[model samples]
Target chain A: MAHEVTVLTAGELRGLVQLDLAAVDVVERAFAALASGTVVMPPILSMAIPEANGEVDVKTAYIPGFDGFAIKVSPGFFDNPKLGLPSLNGLMILFSARTGLVEALLLDNGYLTDVRTAAAGAVAARHLAPAKVETATVIGTGIQARLQIEAAHLVRPFSRVLVWGRDMAKAEACAADIAERLKITAEAVADPARAVAQSQLVVTTTPAEHPVFKAEWLHPGLHITAMGSDQAGKNEIEPAALVAADLYVCDRVSQCEALGELRSAIAAGLWQGGTPPELGEIVTGRHPGRCSDDEITICDLTGTGAQDTAIATSTIAAARKAGAGSTILT
Target chain B: MAHEVTVLTAGELRGLVQLDLAAVDVVERAFAALASGTVVMPPILSMAIPEANGEVDVKTAYIPGFDGFAIKVSPGFFDNPKLGLPSLNGLMILFSARTGLVEALLLDNGYLTDVRTAAAGAVAARHLAPAKVETATVIGTGIQARLQIEAAHLVRPFSRVLVWGRDMAKAEACAADIAERLKITAEAVADPARAVAQSQLVVTTTPAEHPVFKAEWLHPGLHITAMGSDQAGKNEIEPAALVAADLYVCDRVSQCEALGELRSAIAAGLWQGGTPPELGEIVTGRHPGRCSDDEITICDLTGTGAQDTAIATSTIAAARKAGAGSTILT
Candidate 1:
């Protein structure tokens, strides 16, 4: 029998999905599913074309009970920006779990990745950050910087957002976008340490080759979301900062050790704790998150297929509900 | 700038590709590229959905100078046959190596895989088998049994063909198809040894869990192409037969040892020859393929990603020339 595969575009997805707590809940559910012991997630398939300064990673997870699973193709070419194309772009192909037949192709051009990643950050912060976050700082001027801060506001309703970047012009532009979108006081901070010291929640979204924030800047009642460092050799926070944190949780502990900021901490011997519990453990109540307002907490997120599958699931459903995207028969 | 992605269907691809020496050369080129050591192929990403008895593997390779690379998704559902669906089906996604943008989506539904696999077999036989081949035998009665025979006839026009299968009825039907397609005298042989002794070149394409052919059946001046056992623990020839052969080669030594017929041969301790040279080495004259007509040579094939990329490259070009598929924008 022939099948019609639903195809949704990035614009259609953005128009259908609102950045809100509901998104946070969807990601949180994925975390719980990850902790449920029935998800079969293979190691990511990563191939690099160094001549082009590009790499593509394919990630997927098959949750036994779900009707669908997603395979995400994420391509990152550092030189793309010089050619006026975004540095990151790719799509997701979702298949039926029962028959291994493709159900839909989500050509969101990384929109779903951005959405799920932000929702994951917000969910992590909600469980680990202080009850009330008055200010949030994001240390990057990329699309992720603005999106992560906006996602943080969804969880805690932060009134102020501080942005920092190597390129001050991009930083100022990012801050302006945040202010206009959230109707909040958004400022471009020249000093990352100052932003870290003043804010209750800090989000690191840069593709930093070295530490972007210092250990001396961490405060007692602070929570940090390290959204960068999804690849090896990318770091955001000083190892000493991780050592100082009373609670250091990762979106997925194994991934953090292999591909996130926590890898550097472990290599530096600053994070000596025996396999820190995952963010999913806390979300599922398998472990307690933050003990007190004064306890420093850090969540190192390297992203996961579970989150991608969840967002793809919800995105396709919403697209169908709104009658969005084109349909092609196969 | 946005790009339009070409989409080709299985029927279109089947219509465009003719099994011949040109196809054989395409696969041979891929083998040469693999031997050249410039191909960047990551470990296959495989995820299993146990409840459904299904598994999906994604394979790709980036040849440094190619304009595009292919990511092939191959899905296998053991129970699909019972549901009136093929047990294996999937497609390949081709992307621009320079910009990391999708160049095309080959919805060939495993047609490209089938093509390249058969072509590889024929290529191996061309370089390894004796120049004069009058008769050939094929084990198994599925699509591959017919395709492999047709593909082999392109390289060496055999006047007679022998077909063998576990089911005699299917074997007779397969022989009938071969006779009609190749305009040759084809017979369904009941005895494996009789078939081996009657043919100059033999091809085995079964999915046997245990050895289906034995060493006692080996004939002097004959070459065998073991195309089964692409996955672990599947065997076609007796380990003793591999040991009896004077020359043994594989498409890839590492893959053959890990997942092909050689894996079992090594386990049974019937073959202890140190890592055999790959067929590409002989193709490039790095090693001589056959020393004499009576060498009793065997070629164990465990397919590679290079073949997938190469076939995908040509398939897309052919589809473009034929105007055989739809176009979608991303």
Candidate 2:
């Protein structure tokens, strides 16, 4: 019972993995599996620690034909910034589906989560966004904003990138970082509306309590991927913009209805009483995605345990083949 | 951060831990924390695999003022024995409460679960059972049957032990093992009623879907600890027997009402309409346990997350102090 369990730290994971379009394909397949009703994804177990302004969520999914399942414990302590600590950190425990034994522990400190989230955004953009883009805008200076732009590049190559944040200095720094990382002309933009109107693609990656941009900022043929509204009361897209969109898709309709931008739209009395097709349906050829360039398309990604499992499974496999992680008996 | 986490395997844990009366006291403190509204125990996340006749449950509790919290993944594959594997297997992942970091991994393979369960049974008996006992009966020749009898020895010094099982060979073997282990005059008995009539205490531990003993088999001063019905449909004590008992309690009143002996009684329309005081209440001095020797007492144990957290925290502390287990960066 004291068999070796592979242990991959965040730095080790970051060194060994570069999640790009190919990783998006992995997430797409996971979405298809979830849509096929062959995966067992339990409702998240969430606990709140109001005293510390923190919460932890446990998510996992057992795919019918997969070799491993992942149980991810993601914690967010909103007050950690003042203490010189990252607000988000957690680990994933991967188990063998056959024997239910611990296969690996990914103490990635949310590195894998960022990778999967970015990959999921790329997958959605690939299936739903416009084919060509001269300009793109990212509404946040956080880690996800940079990752989303990188992920969005896998779907649509953009020349000029507009970065926005509450703090203009951080926004300028993020723009410099984006320009260096993606090798593009990136600039900090204070006007969210102007940035939105100039770009064909918009990715909002903020923990905003209100809409990131006004609904009127949406332009023709624009596709948006809102990736920040995974929790209740978090909104990165206006409700009116969602109603105005021609095709609305989400990572998981149930999750969206409960904790995503869809929940906000529903709360605003703007959403129609019909379930939109999930992103998986489009990926699996069950529904048409991005019918016309003029059609306003949006994909609400509230995240899924399937993506977590998919990424964890692939990470462990890659780490083992590369001999990138240490092993210890537990 | 690649901090070290103590890893405790099943064999190592078994060698170091003896969960008897003292362990019961540990569990009692956890129950007190739970009852005092200081522990954050979330609803269990459960998933089922119909094809494998299996289910996995993730349970956790964050006790206030504790150093760490434990998330336990308990999976039961009913068809495992066909492949030379036990039906239940899983591990606990303990996280530091302050930083939400990995503290330890207890790969106990259900050893800790079994220990906590036996300790709970002992706690119940210590508070509710008759003080003096010449004989005690245990139904079912499973691992729990052995553990429960050993656990019961902490509260009452029985001179003789009776073991009953459906299979005569297993029953006789279990009795012989008990005699050798506990050094009591033990014998296998086919007649559960006859065994109940002679013994002052009864501990039922089986995966029985039906009642093990009838209500008519009960005698005055008989105290029973039922430890089998943890699922919704499994019962080892008759509803009538529960109704006839003078005092009744369970590890958790809510859990008992949903999946323990109390559920069976309520289904049969025999339970009185009120929440029976929990064992925690009695342990916390809020409720009187056994008042008279002639009054029959019964306690049902459906298990709790608090006990898991307590045991895991204590185990990790001990392992660190004893320099046991392998440490891995997570």
Model 1 agreement with the true structure over A1-330: per-residue lDDT tens digits: 456778776667778876688888989999999888788888888988899999999999987677889999999998998999987888898888888877788877788899899999999889998999999999999989999988988889989998999999999999999999999999998988888888999999988989998888989999999999988879998889888889888877778998998899988987778888888889999988898999999999999999888888887888888888887666
lDDT of each: 0.87, 0.85
TM-score of model 2 (CA atoms) = 0.94
Residues forming the 10-long window of minimal summed lDDT in candidate 2 chain A = A1-10
Best by DockQ: 1
For residue B263, model 2's alpha carbon misses the true position, in angstroms, by 3.5
| Predictions: Cα RMSD each | 2.0, 2.3
Candidate number of the best lDDT: 1
TM accuracy, model 1 = 0.95
Per-model chain B TM-scores are 0.96, 0.96
Query: What is model 1's native contact fraction?
Result: 0.69
Write the residue-wise lDDT of candidate 1 on B278-321 in tens digits: 88887888888898887788999877888888988888888878
Q: What is the TM-score of each candidate against the true structure?
A: 0.95, 0.94
List residue ranges in candidate 2 displaced over 4 A.
A1-4, B267-272
Q: What DockQ results do all the predictions give, each relative to the true complex?
A: 0.70, 0.50
